[model samples]
Target: MKTKITLNKYLLVSLLLPVLLFSCKKFGDVNIDPTKSSNLNPVNQLVFTQLRFAGDVTINERTSIIMTMPMVQQISGAYYNRYGSTYIKNKQYMSELWEIGYPNDVLNIADAVERTQSDPLKTNLNAMCRIMKVYIFARMTDLYGDIPYSEAGKAYATGIVHPKFDAQKDIYDDFFKELKEAGNSLNTSKDAVGQELFYHGDISKWKKFANSLRLRLAMRLVKVDPEKAKAEVQDAYNSGLFTDNTDICKVDYNNITNGYAEIRGNGVSVGINQYVDDGRPRVCNTLINEMKQTNDPRLQYIARAYWTNPDRLSDRLDVTDQVKAQVGLLGVDAGHYNYDNFLGAINIDYPGRGTISVPNGGQKAQLADFLVRSDAPFFHLTYAEVEFLLAEATVRWNLNLGGNAKTLYEKGLEAACTQLSLFPNGPVLTSTQIQNFKQDNQLAPGKELQTIDNQIWVALLMNAPEAYANWRRTGYPALIPAITAESTTTTIPRRFEYPLSEREQNAANIEKALTALGGKDDWTGRVWWDKK
Candidate 1:
């Protein structure tokens, strides 16, 4: 029964395929200004490239659930098909982003770069393409460890069906360099030759984005390469980065049929207008408890509690009537932990304790619209994130950044609060409320590093990949080990294993990569930057 109602994480792309085809159809057969069209010209090519960026960067609802959300503990479930319990061995889930991301997003950017390289007027377009390309490749390498960067997505011209994996360090070096050069090359006077998806053709905003990404990419090297990390912090700080949310890399769904919008708007998105709520996964307890402990207002943004007990479907309260009573359950393997454990975890209150729960007869809280809303802006980077990075940079390397760690930490929380307000309908954190949040969640003057890292983890709720990377780097948030950890006899995975399809088709390169990676390609293998 392949009904639309039963569609899950895997079917999202299948639904979008027809939309991709539909996108190619001519509008009224009049060519619709071929130079400014979505195909066969520079505008169209950049549009496609930007659309691809929207998809792979967690804007698409599918990967947001099955990949980043669960891995980072922002969302989870004990249900049969959710990501919480099945993450480590779910090779198909691990592989989907790679399969779709590289070919569609990376290759399109490459095409745009080629098409605009020689045009002096298209410098902004070409530079944006390069930065977007680096952003995509950075995500790829960060998640999967070493990846095909030098020759990836080049089957058309280079015919490199099996691109060899570049070393992660080398890939990161190139990414930083590309961002620096592209940020400098962006001509503020020369606007994009087309409809710019993120910042709307504002070249200054694009430069801010590039420099912000530099801060992000450099911060990843803090533990592994201190010298390089310090240098990057200095470089990025001097490059004139984002001071507010306006410059954050936000993907607007203005053109619905393009990149992330079409993919996430499909039948499988739980936030879809007609989506069924019967089997949707819930927000995880790890995040809920953290928010509850601080009396955080953002809980209203992330979760919607039940009006009546979810266990009683006959008398089930309309979701519309529910108040914001958040009850989050810790993630455990499906069928292994029972209803009793759930009830026990939820049926308690914490007064000034680190973890707190609001009981509701063992039911879990569904993710709020601030998360699942189809039109919610897909955030690629934020001013809060940069502030967090600067906070850490100041503390760790004693960098000469203007602000101290505490000020930057508070600013990060403020920006995160402001960012959530952008969601269509959510709890509003007013100026007073924001000030109270900062007051309540103040860092102990001595433990600045762990304190700042914990706040960063809380700030990065819907952002999965970056959160996971930070977890690997700093190891704050101190989550309980997975139930599967004892049986599998391993800690949480470090990197997603290379897809099995590569093993079958590109065996030679796969072998070389595996051998370079200490003779295994499973989750336990660390990336070059994860030496800590």
Candidate 2:
């Protein structure tokens, strides 16, 4: 009887065990949210990455407007602008790009590239990802030398919580290789990428962009590695480039006011417009004066001003009145505009200020409405830039880039002018006006390189980082460093310092990078390609 009872208990326990285990498993699944998944769609990931690249308000404000734009002397007259205009160190502004770039743009794009690598159906998507990865890293390495390249964006896949910073030289080499491979890999016969932001999955356009970017990167090597630069430029040119304005790589943003978190609106436009009443930036005399001196037709489209009264919204005067527009087209001298005495010294009178005596913040020109609208297109790479690079290569290396330096230079100027119409309500430059400007601004005999780079400077107006990079490489337009009592340094900053977070979280790798940088992590240090 005892043996029979024991056997029956064992048999019943065994039967219940499987049922209990299955119940626990089902309960575990209930805790997991069905709406959330570990797997990411590569197409959606790519779209998000592209949008964040152009639509990060923090980056646009801290890096571009406050730092690069003022450093390049394109725009100024804001208190925050002192960081670049007067060479004052603001660690927050200096580190924003590195801090934001890695976690957001780098991580997502890297994942997309990795996920699509083995899928046969995702060939074009993979190619686009590769090209975009290069673009993102190039901008990063250009600004902050020796960032984590190979090991970046691999935290989830490889458990690399801390990535090693690769040398800029090695990174550049990889950039060229990746661009070449990606450009060649692009196939129209493959599945079209529905979520592409820059080109809408247009394989041909993507191909042109990749090569044009290669040409631009090659030009950066002029002072560092001329042999490599020439070879790369020749190869990229021969491969094919942007034939016209339509091939320009850009993001046309919608007029959305959902703040920085919203990716549909242009972050740069939102950034600049936020300070419309306070510390509003006026076009720098360096830029406006250059345009005025050259009789550049784009000046009318690029700059405008209003008589502003911060106290009253309705008190602003429109630039449509030709008389007021002419008077308000004044560009402020950067470092000099911060003083109270300087503000008092300006004798200009605005009838719309309610009282001409009040010197409301509108004493100087502001960026035009069309240029700063929430929907303005952010130009990533353009045919104008490609033409200018080719022109520079022709002059510097005597390479046959399908046209003489003069012809290419004029084509760049026309393309630059023509692309402005892409902006919301942007003015159209008539063919005659473009031709007249081209005729007047022809490349000078002794100053071919200078002329080409100066126009490159003008063409890259809103894209401040690119303009700053070009200025560093070519030293065109001959900017004098801002001389002010408030300045922390006499020289312009060559590159951004590493983020403070790197010091706290990734100390060892950052220390290794600092050692390579001669044991200092300051803006004065030059990147590899920016050799003096």
Candidate 3:
């Protein structure tokens, strides 16, 4: 009877032990918490990450209006206090770009790097991150003369709260080295198993993109470091680049919601369609006049005339009448009356014949429908850019490119004109229209390089940062400075002022940086590469 009791007790313990073990076992749901883990594989996270990095037109309102678009005269709008582009806007306009880039690109990419490092399958993913790091940092340094590059995004690991500011030259050098190494390290066999939003894990396309970007950076250093630039160009050429428009680097926004949806910046806020919105920022004189002079059909495709009212758009107006009526606001701070007139100028801001009599209601030229369309793909890089750069490099530096400048220039024009149709739901420009534009706008023999850069600028519309950087690099198209700028006529901003937040929190580092920034963190300070 005692032996029987012992066996029964042992059986009860076994049953309870199995149940306890099962209860303690964790499911994936229990372990996989986004708040706790640094898993960078979530598709949604990648989608938003790309959006943040690529940026929407709405988010870039301040800088675009105050500096890039208006200064370049691609588009025009008013700064918060400044009426239209009449006066120079302060540094606050540039503050948001600096605020967003480091956190989104550097820190986020760093997180992705950490999560991807140990896994062999993520080789392509890791390499892509390295390339993206170059993209963001390049723009960052381009905007601000010096930024924290090498020591940035190391706060968590190395306790580097106040990272040392890296000179733009060092940053560019690092970009060259990193892109070269990272691009070469891309594994075609190993898929991008992480959050591969842009290419959807296609390593081949990623490789092409990497090489093309490297080429662009190489050309950026053409004036500053000729030998290095030549070598990089050759290397990039050897690596590969986008063969066609199909290979352009674009971030699709079709499936993702833009973060800027809640905060639509100041504007006209009305539109007839996705292609021609009644918004604050309208096509500037520089863009529209150029198109008009060339009789470019793309003008009608891009700009809309709000005449009569939103109601008149429904009337039987042909493309001819609409094109004739579509006019952008001049980039001058006219007096209150003139400003009122321009704002209320029929076909100016509000679509229907500038009938917005009230100062409160008049529209400045906002972006066209295609630009404001949420579903439009955010272009990162493109074959058109590559072709134009190649044309410039060959002509300007006499690089030993197999392709001639004329052919490359024409190809660039073709690519740029044809590819404008990428913005979905917008008018698809006809082939004949593109050919006519190309024929009518031939690159002049003496002004081939200038024309190339100008075309590049035109292609870079809405991509204000690149346009600004390229303008700094190659001062083409003879852009007029802000008419009422406090700055000297000879001076346009070479770099953006460092943010106020950096001034307060990272005071010491900022102080040290100001020394390199010529004892003043002013926009007049030229970056190392910007010898022009």
- Best of the candidates, lDDT: 2
Residues 132-244, model 3: lDDT tens digits: 77887787788888888888866755678899898777888888788888788888677644345567667778888888998988887867888888888878878888889
Question: TM-score of predicted model 3?
Answer: 0.80
User: Per-prediction count of colliding residue pairs?
Assistant: 1, 0, 22
Alpha-carbon local distance difference test for all models: 0.66, 0.80, 0.62
TM-score of each: 0.81, 0.89, 0.80
Candidate 2 lDDT, 1-532, residue by residue in tens:
2312322333333233223222322233665533223345667666666766767788887889889999999988878788889899888898888887877778777877887999999999999999999999988999999999999988755779999999999999999999999999999999898557788788999999999999999999999999999999999999999999999998777666466655566788777767656467778888988998889999977776565534322346654244343344566786646333244323344455443332434546667778877677899999999999999999988998999998898889999999988877788999999999988888878999888999999999989999999999999879988879998888999999988888999999999898767899989999889998
Instruction: Give per-residue lDDT, candidate 3, residue 164.
Output: 87
Off by over 4 Å in 3: 1-46, 56-59, 79-89, 254-279, 308-366, 485-490
Among all candidates shown, the one with the greatest TM-score: 2
Rank the models by TM-score, top first.
2, 1, 3
- Number of the candidate with higher lDDT, 1 or 2: 2
Candidate 2, pairs of clashing residues: none
**Candidate order by decreasing lDDT:** 2, 1, 3
Q: Write the per-residue lDDT of candidate 1 for residues 1-532, one digit (tens) a residue.
A: 1111222332344334324422543455564532222444555545555544544333344455555656666665534224433444667767866887776776666666776789887888888888888988887788888888888866554567778888898999998899999999988678554365677678888889999999989988978898999999899999988998877886643212233435423212332222233345566667777778887777765665433333322333323222224323232223132232445334333334434344433355656544554445567788888898898899887777768877888889899888887666656689998899889877776778887887788777666677888888888777665545323424566787788898898888778778756998877788889885
Clash pairs (backbone) in predicted model 1: 38-44
